[model samples]
Target: MKNDLERAFEEARRRDAIELEWLGASIQGRPTFAEAELLDRRGIPSCHVWKIPRNEAPVHLTAIDALRRWQAGACAMCSASPRRLLVDHCHRTGLVRGLLCTSCNTAEGLQSAPSFVAYRERPPAVILGVEEMYGSPWGEEIAPSDASPEERTQRNAAHVDAAEGLFAGITDRFRPECADG
Candidate 1:
């Protein structure tokens, strides 16, 4: 029999594929490249994609799903039990940070407040060993309590830099505006 973790992983993979497909179709019908670029510039993910980390085990979609379950389907920041929780990840590393309800997620993206920074630095998944069960997909778990102030500042800066580069590769794919002949 599959364990809860295994089952969650399987389900996450399935859901991830479905979401990607839906996003692909939805984006094809809209001029969202500009919007995506804007969001990326602000360190807010316009869309979620699963990326394999260099020299590390990939964090599967299951981790996010498992985290959602672990958090009891509530916003990690405000503890509001919303019907659907959005996966909050590091825009730079694509690491699964935590799950948040829509309100908190939106506010965090806009403000980048200290609470969100603290939450990401030591996500509950890393603290409670939920990530370890999934092969520590975050590479090395840096407990917020253990990281020096400098390290945290540097990490946050890296996230900003990476977000600026996130949509760089896709710029060429967007169609340019047409001019009247």
Candidate 2:
């Protein structure tokens, strides 16, 4: 029993040492085995390559690959410009998801973390009235008393029509069949 326990401890230490060495090399900008494979096959840029621990050696795609795949100058989330797009992945699995703008990335990360969920579960200590922050921006443009029910309905319908028209004009590149003529 003592000999078995000693062997297991030694094995664990050896594994930890190897992992630490790998991490050090990674931080020092050395490519992993999987990354090297990608470099040879795809000629992916060194700056855009990264390794993730998996049973089978895995590497995330290059920036050029992402650009080719997504084929737009906008984020996968929020439809914002890709000026500051970040590589997003599953925190638990290290699987690449897609590129996201900074705001969407931060929001997604926060929503998935356990502490953020727990904090949301607890009741708020204080709540502020909507009036305190909102400050009636629509007060000058529109007034409820000025418009009758029928007029209000017409205004709403017009707004909905405008929105639909805007969406219709935007091309859906993902679906070739649905591409604009």
lDDT of each: 0.52, 0.41
Model 1 / residue 90 / CA error / Å:
0.5
* Cα lDDT for residue 138, candidate 2: 42
TM-score of each: 0.39, 0.26
Give the best candidate by TM-score.
1
Cα lDDT of model 2 by residue, 1-181, tens digit: 5698899998778766654543334324445445544553453322233332222111232333433233234444334555666655433222244555686568766664432332222211111000111111244222133566576556545544665687764645556897668
After superposing candidate 2, which stretches have Cα over 4 Å from the reference? 1-64, 67-71, 112-181
Candidate 1, 23-108: lDDT as tens digits: 33322322144553454455434223212122222245356555553454545666556678877666434356777778778887
Residue pairs with colliding backbones in model 2 are none
Q: State the lDDT at 92 in candidate 2.
A: 26
Off by over 4 Å in 1: 1-61, 131-181
Cα error of candidate 1 at position 148, Å: 24
